[model samples]
Target: MRRELICVVQHRLHDKRMGDEVMNIPRLGVGLQFNPSLMDWFPFLDQSLDALEILFDGMMAPLDGPGLMLPTMVQTMDEVVARFPLVGHSNYGGDFGFDELASTPAVRRHVPLARAFGVPWVSNHCFYSDDSWCDVWSSPLQFTQAEVDRLAVRARALQDAYGVPLAHENAAYYRTCPGSDMPEEDFLARLVEQAGTWLHLDLHNLYANAQNHGAAGYSITRFLDTIPLDRIACIHMAGGRWLDNQYHDLHDTPVVEPVWDLLDDVLSRAHPGAVILEYETESLHHHDGVLDIPRSIDAILADLERARSAWDKAYGPGNRQTTRAEAA
Candidate 1:
């Protein structure tokens, strides 16, 4: 079974890589957080999307348990992979960000998906996902060297198991963990260094952090300047809503203007492998019982159009890497 699975995995990976080659550098795309109601939007999105970032946890089944996914979920995911350049983004049950042991379960789930899709890369957040102790606040763990070592071990393990490159994203935090010495950007740099993983830079997360926690003379530009651009594997651009005086990483909305500017800044400095527009629609149902499929699709297409326009201006046909002064 393992040998057969390996063959299947390699075959799929080859097919997707071929598609990516034709598509060329810096794939413009969106997240496919699978939902029954969103099926109608796929045909429209697949028309132009260069790739789809698949949430790994959503497509799995236990194969023998009650909480496990239905058998058909695998088949459905296979269909989705065959149609698009799919990248795995593992939530990894949230604890992996702090402890290497906690990452094992999440990595086990991701390995099969990586093989199934022939994914070239997989990514996860730099912070924990489930917080039993702190529910009211966005409490991101401290930027400590111990955390960096733990994250590196998990990242390397994932890359080995998946036989693909791995990346970890910088998460948004409303409150800093007590007694952290390193700045956020410096911590990211160290983590990438130790893990030998690429950076899955999430622009909106930085937008939120800067808004809520930025220090004096601090800005997104400073944050960008702190990290090595060459390590970037992909970039996530999304919108958030301000709730209770904090910017939430809620994906129900379109890409806001400030996030776009940050994306442009990154494009100017580095040529990332992909730029993904993340939109979550499950939350929309709360406002109304039904999902407005067409409206949601239209909004993303519009957002992608704006992104393409900005992308073209910054790193389009010419590979323009001019400073603002030069462009002016």
Candidate 2:
């Protein structure tokens, strides 16, 4: 069963790689997060966008147990896959620091879907989730050596099960978990190195952490300098708002100025395979509490343009042809 599944995934994902090996993942360039609201604009986004990051949880339904993908959702996925290169994103299960017995089942459930989507790689948060704690969201793990070793085992197991690369994203938290002795960057570097996994760098999350934790300790410069930039395979850019003196990593607005500056800085140093813009369509702040769908779409396109420009500037204009060809 494992061999057959690996063969299926490799066959489906061959076009995106440089060779027959599944390990040779493609460089996807600039892309946007897939949202239902952007369905109407996809036909026109090819010039500005090079790929789409699909939230796999959105396509799932709780049929009997954990969840399954309905036929309609599969069809939607097919349609999108036919249009652009795809990268899978999920927050359910597969948490790096979660219980192995509990998270393994959920990871198994997602493997077939990842193969079906032909995603070269999939990404999830570096946090842990438990119903006993916050049922709706994940919580950051303590940055200790023991936690790093534990999560590395889980991450490696997940990567082997999926038969593809697994990239873990940094979490934005209000406060450091007790007993976290190491810095976030050091923990991440050690974790990825030990696990043989990739890093799905999220600049906005770093921005939020910097805001909440103060620049003297958790600035972007400190993060980029400490972590292994080459391990970053994918990048996420999002917008947030300051409410009650707290900067929330809310995906509900345009890419803020500071985040854009961070993106530029990261691009100049790290050569990530793709940079994706994440905007939540359902957020009230996203539409300014008004239903101006066209205007909102235009704003998204503008952000894509900015991302593409930055990517081209960093990697050179000639590579745009290669990006378009690969995304085709």
Candidate 3:
């Protein structure tokens, strides 16, 4: 019965073909999260990357005030867009569930950058981060029908504002928030179904959640089975560390083995538009004020190469050949 229901929802979501036509977002292939550390290495790494997931917040100045884009940053962005396709990522966008007027300012700032990059879609965390409500960086949403309905309205408005699709990433939380009526997967399924938003599925976040809460009923397979896989816009792969016996989505290390396995599993089931490696450059800099450029570049390139290889395995010439034959 559950499987049948999942099939029904999947069918509904896919039939709509939600944002592809409206946004004109193409299959971006494999890519990396762009950071300042990688600027000097682009010449060497261009061929290995298919697209770049850019943080729009990073390009702006005086984040709290009227945001400004300097000429130098614009030049840098132009160079990046010239070389590869780009996807916009928002780190500080307010809660999708918040009142539209309160969230609009932060959300509105992403539009120009998205247009400048010509990104097919823009993405943000599923959790809320409005400073007025919380001092912490982010907090998980209460998985309730009411919240889903509210988020749906706000998400659609955001997409309309950008004139492109908006995707929300599954956030990694240490503890489930109280007063949630349903599981995260169900919440996401309902949100996407009602809101017409895409899922910027983060494999590391899923892995972290399952690691911390699997005993209580969270797992990768279950999540994949539940959500509308057809709506997954892209995948985020990153590494984290174990602290206090809980896994953290640190994005400061290389891809872990389990995440790699998860990537393969997701690719086999869902064809996301892109796969991106999110590695923080600060992790490569020593506390002694030295930057290990060579080592940092190698680690990033290695993970990207692996992601590309998996992407190729899933959609390369052999798969294309089979697809063509089937079509014929």
Model 1's TM-score against the true structure: 0.78
Model 1, residue 5: what's the lDDT? 39
lDDT tens digits by residue: candidate 1, 1-328: 2444345567766745322132223344333344444564445335545567777666665423443334656556545555556777765444354434433445545576666666667777776644231332355657888877776776666656656667778888777778777888888888778866678899999888887876633367777888879888888888777779877887777777789888877888887767777776633322334346666676677887786666677765433222222455
Error of 1 at 8 (Å): 6.8
lDDT (10s digit) by residue, model 2, range 84-124: 67788877654653555444434655666777668878888
Off by over 4 Å in 3: 1-20, 37-47, 63-68, 95-106, 131-136, 282-292, 318-328
* lDDT, candidate 1, at 135: 36
Q: How many residue pairs collide in each prediction?
A: 1, 0, 0
Alpha-carbon lDDT, every model: 0.65, 0.74, 0.73
Sequence-dependent TM-score of model 3: 0.82
Candidate RMSDs in order: 7.0, 4.4, 9.5
Worst 10 residues of 1 by lDDT: 317-326
Off by over 4 Å in 2: 1-21, 36-48, 63-67, 101-105, 131-138, 282-291, 321-323, 326-328
Which scores better on lDDT, 1 or 3? 3
- Model 2 has an lDDT value of 0.74
